[model samples]
Target: MKFQIQRDRLVNGVNDVMKAVSSRTTIPILTGIKIMAHEEGVTLTGSDSDISIESFIPKEEDGKEIVNIQQAGGIVLQAKFFEGIVKKLPMDTVEIEVHSHLQTVIRSGKSEFNLNGLDVTEYPHLPQIEEDSVLKIETNLLKTIIRQTVFAVSTSETRPILTGVNWHIENGELNCVATDSHRLAMRKAPISGGNGDKSEAVIPGKSLNELNKILEDTSDELEIVITENQVLFKAKHVLFFSRLLEGNYPDTSRLVPAESKTSLTIGGKEFLQAIDRASLLAREERNNVVRLSISEEGGVEISSNTPEIGKVVEEIQRKSTDGEALNISFSAKYMMDALKVFEGAETNIQFTGAMRPFVLRTTSDDTILQLITPVRTY
Candidate 1:
């Protein structure tokens, strides 16, 4: 295999593929990135069994040549050394050639390095997904949905299924939900090409976070394909695949109350700042509890009291309230996380009771809902 490519283009491709490379993977070949030069372009792939990323750089985009292929071939290069070499190459172009016995030479300007390459034939093949159950969504919208819910996924592996964000598509609507038993987040958007087929999948939060970094912040649409155990995200020149979690996600629909006893709307920034200031004292208490007192004429006050430290109280003017007055205690960190996803001027919070879960939604968008369980503090 021999190819001379633009240094900058190669660097971007290598960086994108490296997101899936991990040295501790059980599969030895997965530690290296597969480089295949075909007639159309050069394909670079990285995988660790759980997640796989493939980035393709065409020979020429528009009127300029990106890769000048001398001979079409393939090789598996160690990701650690190859990644470092591409970034440090001091030239406009890089020359790579693999001889017999898997000996590879990389050259740029006045630098030359010889590294032993592995057989690309030994790399595991990516699962081929049929295009039957596919969905297309805007890149920016997908990123928004992820940010709005991915934070709520459980960091612990106790439930396993709680570590992934549950996705449901039906009736031309797509809903993504994540919860860690204490707090939950749900976001919905209308899918462009929904076939009314009811399907659900649990995708690892870690995979979505990595995909968010690789996706471009644009309005371009991307296609998604899902099978029983694998999911594929196809962008313009990049493809992301991840293994789905095997456990059945718990049914959480009943957790959201259909009616509320107390509800109010407050300025998002003001409420966020109030909780932020209150959390400073709660941080020393270990539980990070913040209390909210709502009254008919006293407005709203957010306070946190710690035995070892002083207390903090902030009064925030309510935009509107139309239900019974209530007092509740909850984690300030969880409340702030739910508020950060709101891009509106105000947020609407509905409380079922002091002991029940409360729901938060942006005043402007009913499509996104965030819920957090209140702490039992008398």
Candidate 2:
């Protein structure tokens, strides 16, 4: 295969596909990137069995040539060396050529590197997904959904199902929920162009995070297709595929409380700041626990204590307090994470009880909700 392409475009394509490449794979070929040059464009693919990413650079876009294909062929190059070489190329154009016996040469502006290329036939085949029913969502909105929910997925391998986010679609709305059993995050958004049928999939949080990093924040829509074992996301010039988790995701609907015994309305920034300061002392504790005390007279206080160290108490004013006065203890880290994504001027917190899970959301938006299971300190 021989191709001369714009160096910047090649760098971007290499970077995007490298997200799927892993050096620890059992298959040696998986450590390299598969490059194919065709009449239309150049395609780069990387995979490590669990996830696969493909990026295409068109030969001509907007009447400007991006790739000039001298010959149509394919080869696999070591991702580690190829990525580094492309990024440091001195010129705006790069040339790649393959000769007999799987030998490849890369040249750009007075610098040249020869890499041992693997046979393209040795690479594993990517899953072939049939796009019968496709779901479309805005690029930025999808990134937001992943960011808001993926963080709550369980990091422990004890319950493998909780390591992924549960995705369910009904009535053209997509609901994403993730939880580690201590904290839960849920987000809902309207989608378009599905089969008009109910659908559910459990996507691994790691894969979603990688996909989110590659996707640009834009209003352009991306197509999504779900199969029994795979979910595919297709954006302009890029295709991402992730294997679905095998087990059923636990039902999280019942975890949210029906009503609250204590409710407080406060500014999100102020609440976040207070929790941050209180966590400074709480970090030394086992669970980084912080205590919050609310009074019937609308007085709010956040405090934390460590026996060997010191105690921190901060009195923060609340906009309004209703229901019964209560004292609660929870992980300050969890509260701060929830507040960062809540994203509004006012935050509404509803507590079922001192030990029950509490819900946090913006007063203006009900679609995004964060729940934290409080800790019990006797």
Candidate 3:
């Protein structure tokens, strides 16, 4: 196989696919990237069994040639060395050629390097998803949904299922939810052509995080294909596939209370800053707990204390509150994460009681909701 490609174009393609490449894999071939040159363009694929990414660089896009393919074949090159070589190539173009014995040669203006290449045939094939059950949404909106919720997924592998985000589509709305049993983040958006029928899937948080980084926030629509065991995301010239988590996600609907006993509306920025300052003191504690007390005079007091570190106390004016004064303790880290995604000027936090889970959301927008389980502190 032989190809002469624009250096920058090749670099971008390599970087995008490298998100799926893992350096420590039992299968040695999985550590290499598969490069295939065809009549249409050049394709780069990286996979580690759990996730796979394929990026295509067409020969001509917008009437400009991006690659000039002299031979049509495929080769697998060590991802570590090939990525470094492509980035540091001191020329506008790169020349790559592979011999019958899988010896790869790379050349630039004044640099030449030879590396061992493996037969592309040994690489695992990516899952072929049918286009039957597909949903389309704006790329920007999809990224927003993932960003707001993926962070809440559990990093621990004990439960295994909690490490992935739950995706459910119904009534033309798509709901994405993630929780680590302590805090939950949920986002909802209208999906084009999505129906009321219930369809559910669980996708790894790691996969969604990588997808968010690669996707461009634009008005362009992305097609999502869902099957029993695999989920596929298709952008303009990129295809991302992830293996779905096997167990059933916990039913979280019942966890969100239908009504609240104590509700307070506060400025999102002010509340976030209060928590930030309070967490500084609580960081030394195991739970990083912070306390919130709603005053009868319509003000909220935020405070945190540690045995080794001094306490912090701050007050923020509230928009409105109902019922008796409420005092609650929760993880400051969870509160800060939930507040960062607030889209409006102020957010309404509804507390059922001092020990119950509280809900935080924009009063103006009903599409997003965040819930945090209170930390019990005597």
Candidate 4:
């Protein structure tokens, strides 16, 4: 296989596919990236069984030649070395050629390197999703949904299912939810041409995180296809596939409260900063808990205490408060994460009681909701 590609374009394509390349894998070939040169363009693929990514660099795009292919063929090269070589190449173009014995050579400018390549035939094939259950959403919006929720997925492997985010589509809305039992993050957005079909799937948080990193914040819409066991995301020349978790995501609808005993609206930025400050003191404690007290005089008090570090107290004015004055203790980390999702000027926090799960959301938007279970500061 032989091809010449623009240095910058080659570097970007390799880096994007490198996200799926695992340094250590049971199958040694999985650690290498498969490069296929065809008449149309050059394709780079990387996979680790759980996730696979394929990025295409066409010969010409927008009347610019990105790659010129000759002797179309395929080769698998060590991802670690290939990525480093491509990035440091001191030239405007890179030339790659593979021999019959799987010997690969890369040349650019005055630098040239030779490495042993593997037969692309040995690499595992990516799952071919044929079922047409697909949905489309803006790339930026999808990234926002993943960013707001993926952080809440469980880090432990005890219940493998909880390590993934639950995605449900119904009534032309896409709901992404993630929880680690103690806290939950949920984001909802409307899907174009979406019908009220009830479809549920669980995708690994790690996969979504990788996808978010590669997805550009563009106005272009991304096509999402869901099959029985795999979810595919296609945007322009890139294709991302991830295996779906096989267990049912726990029903979280019941966890959100229908009413609140206390409700307060506060500046989102100020509230987050208060929690950030309090967390420093609370870090020495077992739960890193911070206490929030809604005052009858229309302000909220934020405080935290540690036996060894002493305590901290601050107050922020509120938009309004109703129902009852309440004091609740919860993890400051959870509060900060929930606050990151709110883009509005102020956030509405609804507390059912001192011990119940409270909800935080923007005052003007109901599409996004975050729930945090208060830590029992007994």
lDDT of each: 0.92, 0.95, 0.91, 0.90
Select the stronger candidate by lDDT from 3 and 4.
3
Report the lDDT tens digits of candidate 2 across residue range 1-378: 899999999999999999999999999999999999999999999999999999999999999999999999999999999999999989999999999999999999899999999999988999999999999999999999999999999999999999999999999999999999999999999999988999999999999999998998899999999999999999999999999999888889999999999999999999999999998877554689999999888689999998778999999988889999899999998899899997646999999899999999899999999999999888
Instruction: Give candidate 1's whole-model lDDT.
Output: 0.92
The most accurate candidate by TM-score is 2
Per-prediction TM-score to the true structure, in the order listed: 0.97, 0.99, 0.97, 0.97
* Candidate 2 clashing pairs, residues 3+ apart or interchain: none
Residues 1-378, candidate 1: write the lDDT tens digits: 899999999999999999999999988999999999988889999999999999999999998999989999999999999999999999999999999999999999999989899999999998788877678999999999999999999999889999999999988788899999999999999886645578899999999999999999999999998889999999999999999999899998988999998888999988898888899888645679999999876488888888777898888888888777788999988998999999545899999999999999888889989999999986
lDDT of 3 by residue, 1-378 (tens): 899999999999999999999999999999999999999989999998999999999999999988999999999999999999999999999999998689999999999999999999999999988777678999999998998999899999999999999999887788999999999999999897543457899999999999998898799999988888999999998999999999999999999999998889888988888788889888644678999998776678999888777888888777888867888999988999999988435999999999999999998888999999998998
In terms of TM-score, how similar is model 3 to the real structure?
A: 0.97
The pairs that clash in candidate 3 are 171-196
Give the least accurate 10-residue stretch of model 3, judged by summed lDDT. Answer: 190-199
RMSD of 2: 0.8
| Cα lDDT, model 2, residue 254 | 98
Which residue ranges in model 2 land beyond 4 Å of their true spot? none
The positional error of residue 341 in candidate 3, measured at the CA in angstroms, is: 1.1
What's the lDDT for residue 314 in model 4? 90
Cα shift from native, residue 344, model 2 (Å)? 4.3
Deviating ranges (above 4 Å) for candidate 1: none
Candidate order, lDDT descending: 2, 1, 3, 4
Better of 2 and 3 by lDDT: 2
Q: List the residue pairs that clash in candidate 1.
A: none
